[model samples]
Target: MTDPTPLTSLSSALADVVARAAPSVVSVHSHRARSTGFVWKSGLIITADEALADEGEVRIGLPDGSTVAATVAGRDHTTDIALLRADTSIAPVRLTRTVPALGALSVVVATTRDAPSAALGMVSVSGQGWRSLRGGEIDARIELDVRLRSSQEGGLALEASGEAFGMAVLGPRRVLVIPTATIERVAAQLETRGRIARGYLGLGLQPLRLDDGIGAMVMNVDKAGPAAAAGIRQGDVIVAVNDQKLSGVRALLRTLGPASVGRVVDVAVRRGGEPTSFRVTIGERPEA
Candidate 1:
């Protein structure tokens, strides 16, 4: 085999890329209900799918000691992309028409780690898509290795020349940042909707498996919130919402949609050993 090229003397150009893009990178944490009656925090960040993944009370720590609330604006499942909003503002990283070639050197940064971490690696693959274990296939994704840590999700990865190439999302030690261009398109959709917000029902649910049906079994209810006010109680089997059958969490999200944000809706559940219906007015998610 021929001798390999020296990496250290590559060029002055590569150094500039890391310096320019690292600041814009961020870390995200999301909270979900668990069987223990407590909330658990996890990260599956990157700029995409911001709405679905709970980056609970996002605290973006900038290099300049600035921390701002990062809100989930919108997400397009077809493309697996989500947009986020920050009040302090950032000098949005610029993009290029050209994509990173295979084996291009890049750096990834996690702004939300217990102690921030950085890694150096090369793009092992590009223009690839994978079906998420969560469902839905993400396309035009770049796969690289930057020695990512647990909280590195939703961080930023940059080309050696500093132009933003993508944002980090997943893998074990391998990192994948969906291309920045795709993120821009989804952010546009979020902007049209005004601000990023989520709704809360204050009910805990467990998936029910049955031969002829699919549903969630209510394990607990927020007694002081909408679910309790509407007569929802633990042990209720939610079979449907507003006429639409509930299949799973994804289906439940669609049923809520954007229209549910302040409107009262009918919820069908099996309570007290009998089928029942109740109307609950959806409530706004608390500001982080």
Candidate 2:
């Protein structure tokens, strides 16, 4: 046997990761009602927007078993990330990196009042887009491919090297963690103004279905809308709206909604891969 024993302990890496990340991982308990007007309770601690479908009150249970009331500070429905501030002060996890490039190994840990669950995976792609949460939608999302357990939905997603990446967000079958890079950017805005500011494009656009490959297609450009005003055509295959790149239908929706009107954002698209650009002056989005 080549050295039956090693000097370092077995759980060293895990222990280090936990030590650095545990403080930020909080236990979220929500008060949702049963159909009968009686409270039939189910619990999930969230660091993601799905947990805050409607902005309201929630009880955050700390690792030390102290529970404090937290209010929804702000929510980016398009990105599926929500910010919650405790009624009392607690130490927060500092975020360092915002983007997880393709092939980056990362770990996810979710804990209930009982146990903690962990899983590992690599970043399949790196980009911001949108996703649907319980009652709302998330935009400018950072998508990942880690397969998350049912218990892992509201937990933390940490990089293998022990940095806090983002919170374990969601997907129907895949684990989507919000990259902390974007979170810090939005959180600053939320902390200052109580909400996230997004650049909006006025018209509704759909993903273009093509025989060659996947891309975004514009179904309609609202009359006198941002796209119309900017001279964007109905058949435009949106490659990039603003700084975020577009790959398909999902990308287009993620970029369009929640974009603030009057903000000037760029739109890069490929009309048959020829590559064109537009200066879109986003207009106001009507209230839902």
The number of the candidate with the highest lDDT is: 1
Tens-digit per-residue lDDT, 150-255, candidate 2: 4456566667677766766667666676666556665555566667544456566665655655667777777766788888887778776675666666455544
RMSD of each: 9.9, 8.8
Instruction: Determine which window of 10 residues in candidate 2 has minimal summed lDDT.
Output: 33-42
Error of 1 at 84 (Å): 2.2
User: What tens-digit string does per-residue lDDT give for candidate 1 at 58-119?
Assistant: 54455565555656555555445655555544455555435688898877655444334556
Q: How accurate is candidate 2 locally (lDDT)?
A: 0.59
Model 2, residue 286: displacement in angstroms? 5.9
